[model samples]
Target chain A: MKKYIWDGIFKNNPVLVLMIGLCPTVAVSTTVQNALGMGVAVLFVLTMSNLTISLLRPMVPESIRIPIFIIVISTFVTITDYVMHAYAPAIHKNLGIFVPLIVVNCIILGRAEAFASKHTPLPAILDGIGSGIGFTLAILGMAIIRELLGSGKLAGHIVLGTKFAATPILFFSLPPGAFLAIAVLIALTRLRK
Target chain B: MIRMIRSLVLVCVVAAGLLSWVYLFTKDRIEEDTRQKVRANLVELLGDTTLTFKPVIPDTLWEFYRDTTKLGIIFRSYGKGYGGPIPVLVALSMDTTILAIRPATPAEGLKETPGLGTKVTEPDFTNQFKNKKPSQIKLKKDGGEIDAITGATISSRGVVEAVQVGIAKYLKYLR
Candidate 1:
């Protein structure tokens, strides 16, 4: 059980190692709050989808499993989107289309096909949580770096102090900055091995 | 094949049923949230909570009143932004000078590049429009009084032009 969770956070780290679902990771990592919001949303969807798919494995025909997985995933995504919009309007607005775009996130679909379809509900859920954590940690790390350097702030507060001389690197706040940060992260993870 | 189709249909039926349930649960709250957001933005733009707004063009334009006295008018405008059209709400006093301005919330389709183009929605940018005549709406580069946001020239220009065009089209309704 521990191994299942460990593999996702370290061994099969979704963003750094597996390199899936990079779209939202890069797009929403511009702010720490956005990164956290996306992370929680992905975690909920991933866990629920994995559990549902695993339970339905016995009944779902192999020929149409892909469509079934999609239906399940999109249903969860829409629910998350609605709930976020209703309750957390600020985060929902910041997340924008990315919330609905969660339906296309390959991590959820990839897990459904490669792991959940074969595993039992318990293992499937563990795997979901593991991968979700891996994704959250990777994106959160990137957000901290980008937000701090790009805006000279942490989670929207100016932490660097007024005496700091150098101007915030605007490049770190742009798309190119996301690529550079992710590349450095990938390189660092590789170096650890 | 029949079995495959049967299972697919069954899965879809179940999924649809579940989605409808969730939608029904969230529908009223979502609409209420939207109405509240609009009200908040209206209050912020008009600078008064006590004012009541009535639609002159039904969502396109509205007139704000304070106890039967017409205070000003607010209208919606769109600009061709970096990602797509940016909708702005501009409030004008009875004499037609700008009262205040606001961009659409992200939920209302204000899709601009984050950190750069998105700055147009911030007060530092929107506030520049306040108390200015329509002739002063253009950016400094275009020989107008308003200063454009750094590194966000396109988006800044988009809002400036949107307000310019919106006022041109809607000014007659106020008169």
Candidate 2:
């Protein structure tokens, strides 16, 4: 249980470790709000897909299983795309194709292939929720740092007073900023280990 | 033999059942979502409270919005941006006077540079394009009109140029 739940949080965090789904990670993380929106979206899709895969595990033929998992994930993504478009156009616009791209997030597919097929429904769902939360926390952490340094304003609101927000460090908002931030955080994490 | 056929039929039925379940759940929403997106994009680029917009026009081309009497302006603005193309829709008052400019997609290549290129979507930048004539739309470099962004010359210039070309095309057709 611990391995299943804790692995995603840090030991095998998707963004921090495996580093799949970097596109959405960077794009939707412009603000803390967008990051939360995307994090929730990922959490929902990952959990639902995991649960469904586990429930259907017994009968799925091994050879054709990848296709089955994909279909299940895509269906959830479409639902999210539609729902977000209708209710949350801002987040919808922000997320863009990266939302559809979730159908291929290595974490979701990895869980399906690695755990869901062999696990029971409850454990699979728990594992999904746990890992999804881990992913959410990881992305949120990245967003906080990026928003702080890049925009000098977290979530579009003026943080650190208006003065600093107006003249944020130039490089933090660039591509190199993202790479540098990710590198430092990972390196810091390793030192802690 | 009868039992084997029944089992095979059962598996096929299950597979079909799952497929239909997902399809039924996702179909209408996807279409509705697209409709909403196009509408929002039109609004963002066009900014007319009265006109209704449609996405039937070619990509980065016209956004169709019609008032009660007849069809309204065709949006025609886009720029070669830092990462990619920044497309916009310009509305007119039928006499070729400006009506609105709704910015659509920001350049696609700016994912890594959101702090910079993403600013292209800002109202401050988009607002400058509104109410200006094609002749008055060039960047400060050409000595015609708009101000280039302080740090992001490429993005600033792209928006100005897109409006310049788009207005020229739209005005010709409107006349």
Candidate 3:
């Protein structure tokens, strides 16, 4: 049980190890706030979809399992979209199409097929949570580095202070910066292993 | 095959039911949020929360009034930008001098490139339009007073043209 949770964080870390769901990781990690928002949204969708898929696994016919999983996942994504837009309009606006695009995130669908469809509800949820945490940590790390170097701000606050006053390296805030940060992070993880 | 079809139908029906419930629950709040944001933007642009807005053209143009006195007018305009149409909200006082201008937010479908073109929405860019006449509303390169963003000439130009064209179309309504 513990292994199910820990494996996702350390062994099969989604962004660092599994490399699924990279689109949002790169797109929204420009800001730590955005990264956290995306992380939480993914967590909720993943956990709920995992639970629903596990519960329905026995009854879901083998021939049509993929489509049923999609139906379930998309339902949860839509719910998350509505709830976020209603309550967290600022972050919802910042996230833009990425919120709706969550329906197609491979992590949720991957788990549904590999873990949730076979596991009991409890373990399926734990795996969902573990994967979610792993994803969040990876993206959050990227956001901190990107936001700090790219804009000299941390969660929108100027942490580097006015004294440090060289113009921020704008490269860290663009798409190439996202790619470079991810590559360096992956390399560091590999070195540690 | 029969079982597969049955299960798929059942899952879809259940999903649809759940989605409809959520949609119904959130619909009103979403609309209210939008209205509140528009009001806030109007207040910010006009710099006066006390002013009441009367629609001159029902979502296209508005007239701001403080009691019996007419304050100014605000209208929507669009600029052809790199990403797509950039909607701009422009406010002009009774004399036809610009009061303030704002670009559509990302939520309102402004799709300029983040950190580059999106800077056009920032105050540094939008504030340039304030207190300027329509004739002065062009990028410095085009022999006008406003300056374009360092790397976002297209977006900056879009807002300038949007305000220019908007003023041309809506200024007559002020009189």
Candidate 4:
């Protein structure tokens, strides 16, 4: 049980160490606030999906279990999408297709198939929370570097200079910035050991 | 056998129940939120507060056509952008002048660096369209007005083109 959590959080993070779900991880990492907003959304979906899948494992037949898991995860995603669209439309708009793409996120579904189906419900939930944190940490780290150097702002405020937006090295906020940031973050985390 | 069937039915019911709970809780907030964002966008465009949302149109796709008297307008226009469609709002004065324009999805999901294409959201870029017409619109190189954000010609052009479509529609709707 602890092994699944340690593996998710540090030993094998889905984002930083494993480098999964790279799209939203880098896209929303522009601001700490955005990163956190997206992170919590993923966290909520992952935790609930994991819990529901685990609780239903006993009744799920092997032949149709994958289909059942998808329907369950997507239902939670649609629920999350609707809530975000209503309550946090800005982030909702910003996250865009990636939110729907959560249905295809292997991290959530993979755990459901591998660990949650076999494990006790409590362990599955903890594993979900730990991995959710791991993903959040990776995205937040990318956001810090990106926001600081990309636009020279912390949240939306100018911490570097008012002209930071006008300076060169404008690559920080672009899409490619996400790829490079993730690679560097991955390498740094790799070197941390 | 009976126990297994009962358990599956129980889980399905719980899932349905949870989904309904989520929907009920979200229904009001979602409506209020959209109203709030549109309200903010309208306020930014019209610069009028007391002019309350006159539900001039029954749909979310807000459009207004005025007679001798002025009416409010809210409509969306899409532009060719780097990644995909960029949604732009055209707010108008009944007299045919543009009151304000807001760019949605600045870079159209392109992962371009911030402070570059992202600057399209900045006041300087979007705010330039204020009170301007389609004729006055063009990149500085083309000799009309508004300078393109450096290293972001595609994004700048997207905003320019989106504004043009909105104006054309606004004109047609008035006529």
Query: Number of the top candidate by DockQ?
Result: 3
**Model 1 bad stretches (over 4 Å):** B55-58, B79-86, B94-175
Evaluate candidate 3 and give its CAPRI docking class based on DockQ.
medium
Per-prediction CA RMSD (Å): 4.1, 5.9, 3.7, 5.4
User: iRMS of each prediction in angstroms?
Assistant: 1.0, 5.4, 0.7, 2.4
- Poorest 10 consecutive residues by lDDT, candidate 1 chain B: B104-113
Task: Put down candidate 2 lDDT per residue, B86-115, tens digits, no spaces.
Answer: 665666656555555645443433321456
lDDT of all predictions: 0.91, 0.71, 0.91, 0.77
Residues A156-178, model 1: lDDT tens digits: 88898754415888899999999
**Per-candidate DockQ versus the true complex?**
0.67, 0.19, 0.75, 0.41
Q: Mark the regions of model 2 whose C-alpha exceeds 4 Å error after superposition.
A: B1-72, B76-88, B96-175
Give per-residue lDDT, candidate 3, residue A105: 96
lDDT of 3 by residue, B1-175 (tens): 8888888889989899999999999999898888787778889887888899887786679899999789889999999888999999999999999989989977678999988999988998888888988889889999999999998999999988888889888879987
Collision pairs in model 3: none
lDDT of 1: 0.91
lDDT accuracy of residue B83 in candidate 2: 67
**Per-residue lDDT tens digits of candidate 4, residues B81-129?**
6656667777766666666777764434433346676677778888887
Using TM-score as the measure, the top candidate is 3
Give the poorly placed runs of model 3, Cα more than 4 Å off.
A157-161, A165-167, B55-59, B81-83, B93-98, B105-175
* Residues B128-150 of candidate 1: C-alpha lDDT, one tens digit per residue: 88899999888899999988889
Model 2 lDDT at residue B71: 50
Write candidate 3's Cα lDDT for A1-193 as tens digits: 9998898898999889988999999999999999999999999999999999999988988888898998999999999999999999999989989989999999999999999999999999999999999999999999999999998999988999765426888999999999999999999989998
lDDT of 4: 0.77
